[model samples]
Target: MSLPPQANSTRKALVLFSGGQDSTACLAWALERYAQVETIGFDYGQRHRIELDCRQTVRRELAAQFPAWGAKLGDDHVLDLALLGQISDTALTESRAIEMQANGLPNTFVPGRNLLFLSFAATLAYRRGASVLVGGMCETDYSGYPDCRDNTLKALQVALSLGLDQSMTIETPLMFITKAQTWALTEQLGGAALNELVIEHTHTCYLGERQQRHAWGYGCGSCPACELRAQGYEGFLAQQRAGA
Candidate 1:
């Protein structure tokens, strides 16, 4: 969807940043449009907890490389949602094989993950005076996580607004866009420099493997997240070449 009016700089935004590719792009998108932007992450004891570290690098690089966005960037909050990990037995939170479940969903699917994430993000936003909540929960290129669906987030938006008695807007800029489009969006938001920054800094491996780096970024190259990123990067290059 088109971004909220660029003129609305008076509004503050809170992004649900997981230090992953999509969330990193969402952060850039928020930085480009919002006057003030803050980021929130959940430390739910996932196997790839390295993403938590990568987020800090992404933030620092963004501030150092883009002064304008850096000025707009605000506080970073990391919530200890260890309860989520305790409750979830998925491949992400546990040491298990990444495979499909009999129910048709992947083992990586964490139940109520996005739901809990948005709820907590909204709570934080309410306290931070940020009316706009931005997330990278995309339906276009995802692992069929029900919580990532647009309708799920839309419903939660209404519930959050009603529960808080405030008009809260959940903005998913990447909801309808493909992963390749997400790469293009990063370039559009902050140019080639931002694209490179995201590529080098963001972490998408479910296994938390950073020892090996690829043309797309760092990952095990076998997990679903890594494969999606690799294919998307190739598609992004193809788009650039075709345009050239």
Candidate 2:
């Protein structure tokens, strides 16, 4: 997927960055377009709490590698949604084996996670003077989280605009693109440098394993997140070889 550069660089946008691979790609996507971009994360007592640390590393590396984007990167906010974890009994928040639930969604799906993330993000954007909210949520190449659906987000956008009485836009750069395309997007946004930054700094493993590194990144290599990332990387390399 080729992401076009934004001509209107004056727009201010807030990104829902979780320090994961998709969000890292979206961050690069936003920095390329928006003039001033702020980031927000939620600490919901996730099993992969290492992502919290990865977010900081990714931010530092991005600023160091691409000073141009670093200038546009603004303040980052982390909200404590620990209550979310306390109330939910899921694979992502608790020590349990991941499997399919009776509802057909994966046990790793944290209910209302994205919805709450967006609501809080909209509130922050309201205060920060940003009219657009960016996230990496995607219905494609995902674990079938309901809140990641495009329709769900569009409806939330309408609800948020009306509730805030302010016009708001939610940007999902990875919404329609596959995981392979997302990798391609990172390269398009910042070339091989950004791709390397994502591979080295971003964290997506549900188990939070970083002891071993793969050609794609660090992960346990068997979890769903790791599986998707590895497959996407292989596809990305295949595309590169074909083009070469």
Candidate 3:
């Protein structure tokens, strides 16, 4: 998909970056479209704290590799959402095995996660005078997370605009794209080098195992998150091979 033209070089954006593949791709997407881009991550006491480390690593690497683009990013913010983890007992927060919930949601599903995240991110964007907020939530190839749906994000966008009494466009470049498409997007935004940097630095394992690497990236290779990433990367490789 073609990226929309930037309204102005002064226009800034705040990206909801989790340092996972999708969010990392969104960060790259934001950098390409916005004159100034800032990223925010949540420290909601997740069991996989390695993702947070990945976030910082990715940020530093981007700053080093793409100095011009990285200069556009303001101070990165990592919010404390420890209370959310305290109240929620799920696979992502606790030691429980991942399974489908009784209500049909996955055990990894943290209810209202995106809602709260975007809400907070909107506030941050407003304060920073940013007209755009970007996130990597996707319905396609998702693990049945309701918050990842485009409709939900659109509704939340309207609600946030109304609440803030300001015009804020929530950009979800990865909303409709599959994970394989996300990898392609990384290349589109930067190049093969940036894509390789992401694969080498970003962490997506629910189990947070970094020692063992896979075809996709670092992960336990057995967790649901790793499986999804591996599948998408495999699909991406297949597509590349077929095109070749």
Candidate 4:
């Protein structure tokens, strides 16, 4: 879906950013819509801690390269949730081999991760007097994470609003878009330069390797995350070549 026009400039928004392609795009999306946009990242003790570095790098580059939107970037907050790592044995938090569960969920699936993230983001937004919480959870071209579904986010939005006794809107701009579409979105938001920055700075690989560059992003190229990103990027390039 195309982004709606900017509403009240005084309105504030908090984005659940992971410094990944989707979240970075969501960050730019939020900046376009809200006058005040702040990003929050989770240090959930994931094995791929390099993502945090990528987050910082992207934030800095955005502020430097795109001053108008970048200046809207408020304080960047990183919450320490190391306990999540201790409690979960998933490949994201653990060094174990990534595999699919009987239910077809990859080992990277961390139960309640998004739930907790949005809940926390709501609390933060409430404190900041923000009415909207932005995230990058997408069911399309996703890794089969149940929490990424639109229905799940809608339910969480209700629960958060009821529990907080405050009206809250959870914005999932990427909910129905594939990765290739996500790339298109970045270009639509800020043009080709923004898209290029996302491709170069965002980290989507499950293995968290920065040196090995591909058309998609940096990754070990062996993990499921890498494979998905690569495929989507290839599709995007093919579409571009076909003048679609």
For model 4, what is the C-alpha lDDT against the true structure? 0.88
Tens digits of lDDT, candidate 2, 1-244: 6566787598899999999999999898999998999999999999999999999999999988999999999999999999999999999999999899999999999999999999999999999999999999988899889999999999999999999999999999899889999999999999998899899989999999999999999999999999999999999999999999
Per-model TM-score, in order, reads: 0.97, 0.98, 0.96, 0.96
**Residue-wise lDDT of candidate 4 within 213-240, one digit each (tens)?**
8877788999988888888888778878
Top TM-score hit = 2
Report lDDT (Cα) of residue 207, candidate 3.
80
TM-score of 2: 0.98
The weakest ten consecutive residues by lDDT in model 2 span 1-10
Error of 2 at 37 (Å): 0.3
lDDT of each: 0.93, 0.94, 0.87, 0.88
Model 4 misplacement above 4 A: 1-3
Cα displacement (angstroms), candidate 4, residue 209, comes to 1.1
RMSD to the true structure for each prediction, in A, is 1.3, 0.8, 1.3, 1.3
**Tens digits of per-residue lDDT for model 1 on 1-244?**
3444688688999999989999999898889899999999999999999999999999999999999999999999999999999999999999999999999899999999889888999999999999999999889998888999999999999999999999999999999989999999898888899899988999999999999989989899999999999999999999999999
Worst 10 residues of 1 by lDDT: 1-10
List pairs with backbone clashes in candidate 4.
none
